[model samples]
Target: MERISKTITAYDKHCDVYNDKFKEFEPYVQKIKEFIELLEPGMKVLDLGCGPGNVSRQLMLSGKEFSIEGIDLSEEMVKLARKNVPSGKFSCRDLRDISFPAESFDAILLSFCIVHLDGTEMADLLKKVAKYLKQERRLYLSFMEGKKDGFEKTSFSEEELFFYYHSLEKVQDILKDNHLSINKLTKQGYLESDGSITTDVFIFASKGN
Candidate 1:
């Protein structure tokens, strides 16, 4: 497998404060809950790019029983995930390179992740995800939605990590191509640090034949 991408490695330099900055993001709560409510308890779940494990924490907010494991390119993020959501397992590995048995997970949560990947990477990621997910099993994604795909530099960080935006139509087509059926696609707006409102797309899909 290839080495981690430059943008992901850049995140490690700021891992010390990653949790302090993102652990408070609560917008994913309702969306995650909506997905969980449809499933039975005790299903194993994977939290891909689970920075600080905020999504894992949100999934557990309802006292629901589920097995969770998270992977991130930044080792520091894994460390914080362990501290933030002790009950869930955390690993420092790139999601693109990780392997799992077929149908290993009942559901997968990808919160505020995948925005860094363009169409090709996203397609590859979803195909790998399908291998580990059972037929009809769910996949949740949250990303910065844009009308077109491109890179944007950070406004507050010293490091020049580029954020990639993939259009909603392109993403949905990728999912379909990877044999995943879309269940829901919704958008939520939140105020950025500059007090400007930005919309994020949340998608729930099921693995298909």
Candidate 2:
């Protein structure tokens, strides 16, 4: 897990830069707002892979009156997130290894995250997360779609500390095998640095219904 450790360390050292470059905060907030509109008040929410807590802060501000927890592997990101959303709890930890009782959360937010894991690990993580979700609880996940790389083949640098381009069919099968039912799969063209566009997919899942 050296790459994972290095990626977390790089984010810890450059939280601000990562946050700025991603520009995911806006869409992240908007997505949570959309989800909150569908949720009942007083629900418990988990922001998985919540980098810097931008989406968590927005969830707090959306007037849902719900309990929320944000988690990330990068301590620096968690520290920045705590500063942003003082009312909520933020922890530095891996999503695959999150520990919570079964049926603990009403919803889990996974925005622009989860694509980092290899297929096997992703499937295992989904099963683990399913244990923590209450009945009808939602799992919102987003990914930049393309291709897959073996865990050993993936690498990252200080400036580019994450990899994407995952197959949609593989992701769907993984979730399906884990008992998380996908309600929707939205695909769009994501513009790259060289002005090229690639397809991206976002999925909304719920406990087996």
Pick by TM-score: which candidate is best? Answer: 2
lDDT of each: 0.77, 0.75
Clash number for each model: 0, 1
Winner by lDDT: 1
lDDT of 2 at 15: 82
RMSD of each: 2.8, 3.1
Candidate 1: worst 10 consecutive residues by lDDT? 147-156
lDDT score of residue 52 within candidate 2:
83
Error of 1 at 4 (Å): 6.0
lDDT of 2 at 69: 94
Q: Candidate 1, after superposition: displacement of residue 40 in Å?
A: 1.6
> Would you estimate the TM-scores of all the predictions?
0.86, 0.87
Residue range 69-97, candidate 1, lDDT tens digits: 99987787788889888899999886667
**Residue by residue across 1-209, what tens digits does model 2's lDDT show?**
76677567677777886666553545545666776776778889998888888778777787777798998888889998898789888898878777889999998888766767766777777787788899877888887776444232211223445555567788788778878899877777765555666676777899876
Candidate 1: stretches off by over 4 Å = 1-6, 147-156
